[model samples]
Target: MTETGDLSTAGAQNGHSCCAPATSRAEAVDSHVSHPGADPAVNSESEPEFSFDFVTAGGTFDMGDPFGDGHPADGEGPRHRVNLTEFEIATTSVTNDDFARFVADTGFVTTAERLGTSAVFAMLLETNPGAEAHILGQAPGVPWWVEVSGANWAAPEGPGSTIDNRRDHPVVHISWDDAQAYCAWSGTRLPSEAEWELAARGGLKGRRYPWGNRLLTDGEWNCNIWQGEFPRTNTLDDGFIGTAPARHFAPNGLGLFNTVGNVWEWCADWFTRDYYQHSPQSDPQGPDIGDKRIMRGGSFLCHDSYCNRYRVAARSSNTPDSSASNIGFRAVRKAH
Candidate 1:
């Protein structure tokens, strides 16, 4: 039930919670099981070939706390219990270079490419528009988030823009369909909701921050997020204004990098407001069909004053077909 946003531009400024019951999710998975058909887990057969870092997480854990402290309205209430089996997730969000190879081979056109442009937030001031650059914006990031024409993975800034210099940064302005396409080609799949949450938590039981509560230990910055005023001044405390490299920050207790900040990672689950009310206790997937798809890992823009969802447990969603400049994805798969 959290609002939609990018943690990078909006730092401390972004985006949801959803848990469904066991019976419902179980029924949905079973009814919709279709064929168990192609072992979605068997990437050994794909030509694109994907290799996962494969972090191993196990044991019982508290899924979500609706009535816990500072809980949001839509995330759920009365908290819940869930047990996750063994699983593996990518160490970082899919990078530009990583995605480029997929497109170069498949000629995959991203949603932003197909739609012309995605939502881009205007994050800079209008002063000294003539300083330097090759775009028509006054500040840094698009502050207004207008659907400018000709914006996509190739043209992140807009019309005349290009990803030539940003091949190292994570690919943004992508939709759920785009993410799925990449995963399909890469021989990997999106992490399930339970798998995503467990990975974000990094095996920590109740600590807020990934490294065990205490956002800062002895004045040292932990995650990569905004430190100064949002949407205007960033203070560059994290040495980054927008999306930092996927490996910018330290890894969680599980040794997984960028669990909280940098970019909101897309997961394999459709969104439902009341799903968490009765979410399953063990490896719950999600509702059958809903409007929005699930996204996790609050980005670099998370802040308490506005969007403090950078925490490992926070979540949000958007239309499956929707794409934005702030949103991106990583891939996950079962271990052999």
Candidate 2:
């Protein structure tokens, strides 16, 4: 993942791979479309009201890579124990309607909307080829991501797209600063990387996923993730291709929904690949200074063929001002 001064780049940057069965890819192309909008069966019901449904968590748990299968360059290894103070985290990510309310009350403008542009997936831009002419550029290495004018939180897929029926979906194209602004207005803050890991684990120990060792439970999908080819086709086997509702599936043991998938959630920490080497054992925040902010929980675009960072211990980062179609965040508060 290339890090530059540009603000229109896709915030999510990681390196990995995982592929579905070869047979699944061929069938996926025909059955799946470029976008995953509101599925009536998945989101016709309204989202749970944003009541700061916070889950209080505290104590020590193993943090970082446990399997040693993660990329060495990204620095996911030498798993260690991290102790944390009690804190309350929102049970779900901030939804579009939740952000709209914040904007209505504070008149705050997101970086994307202010810049009048943001990075959109190539698939979505396919429907409107003319948008390519308005392109600011492309994300380095990931050319499928095009930076287009007028692509913001309101018009996530660029022009002619709307969140009219996606009020329950997590708001995307939100930069780290935008998320921080919302947290400030709500009297909360984003969770530290350690705190986020603790809450995501849901009291489980050394589990690859939030629910446990298994990716699926009793033939039931636990999160919204890409089910077919990476970037090329999403089979939508989990019932979603893009962002899903904040409460699309059952919550973890701690009652946190979509903690490991749906969208990459921003965390409160300056990212450093080697920070874990000297991190504090007690309530460890991240590095004191860095070029990028940390982002966790892989998005619906994640696939095994490439970018399998959806695991509980995996992570990625982006410049604080960068925003994209598959990035969002949640808020937290220290318990008194």
Candidate 3:
């Protein structure tokens, strides 16, 4: 959606990209809900929008880690710096109630409900492969991923899944389109990758996690990242197993919550692992055209043994139309 590319050359607008080509996870997957009674149809013209409170981050901030950890993905490399002008961003992610308000007014259907099923990390699936299966499959990760039947955002595990117990929790199973629709309906927008990292830092540098370099300073959980042993069990030391409220953990230096873990927050730009190779010193939003969109802030599923993408700089991508019960979004009121 970035419409500010260089226009020097005669055909630069549509010219071949000078940056490395981005992988193709940009395709939007449809998770339309056709259930008996759910949300109404949502399109570009929905109205009665919503509003959010945001914080403006100005000046430069260190965007990457000072020390390397396990399983640093390819895109995290060439650690760089960025100097952003003032921009206000929501302090918390979009909540279920917030999205509910959008649905109540505009009748928006999330991508998960639309798909009937979505790609869920296999580790989250209770199925042990010997259980009943329907198009069940796994993606290559530590615990592996499963495309379980009926695993949409509502029922994270499938037909039996639901968001009923989780109200204060952030709404998962949203696709890029779903998030964009909610943002539009609410009069907000998704944060650019840089803006997100800046807000997440809360004005801290060289810190491993959002609150600080330490996961726990005074024998307490600062963020809603994974807890207990990986894959097998969770102690819920952070007062949550799957997910907590958007404000469950302590806010970072900038007063943002869950910037490290909870659910992957969608960004405005398309995914590009190597885009940082040529990242501009000022607000680099990423490549113009690509398949997959960028997702940051790992989820409750993140563990050091497997997917520890919860780090401040760690990144991953998913198809625009693909929605996961572990995926949700936050919005940024435009800075004027």
Taken over the whole model, the C-alpha lDDT of each candidate is: 0.61, 0.74, 0.64
Which regions of candidate 2 deviate over 4 angstroms? 1-52, 126-133
- Candidate 1 lDDT tens digits, 269-297: 77766787877777777776665667776
lDDT of 2: 0.74
Per-residue lDDT tens digits of candidate 3, residues 59-139? Answer: 887776567762344377667888876777888888777777777777667655644446555545553343236434443
CA deviation > 4 Å runs, candidate 3: 1-52, 70-72, 121-144
Model number with the top TM-score:
2
RMSD values for the candidates in order, in angstroms, are 7.4, 10.6, 9.8
TM-score (C-alpha, index-matched) for candidate 1: 0.79
Residues 1-336, candidate 2, lDDT per residue (tens digit)?
222224332323335212100000011112121111111121212332464488798899999988875666567766899998888889999999988887777678887777677777777776567677778776556667777788888888787778888998999989887887777667678888988988999999998989887888998888888787767776778987678889989888999999988888888787788988999899887876676667888888777767777899987876677778888998887676
Q: Model 2: clashing residue pairs?
A: 17-304, 18-304, 18-305, 19-305
TM-score of each: 0.79, 0.84, 0.78
What's the CA error at residue 312 for candidate 1, in Å?
A: 1.5
Between prediction 1 and prediction 3, the one with superior TM-score is 1
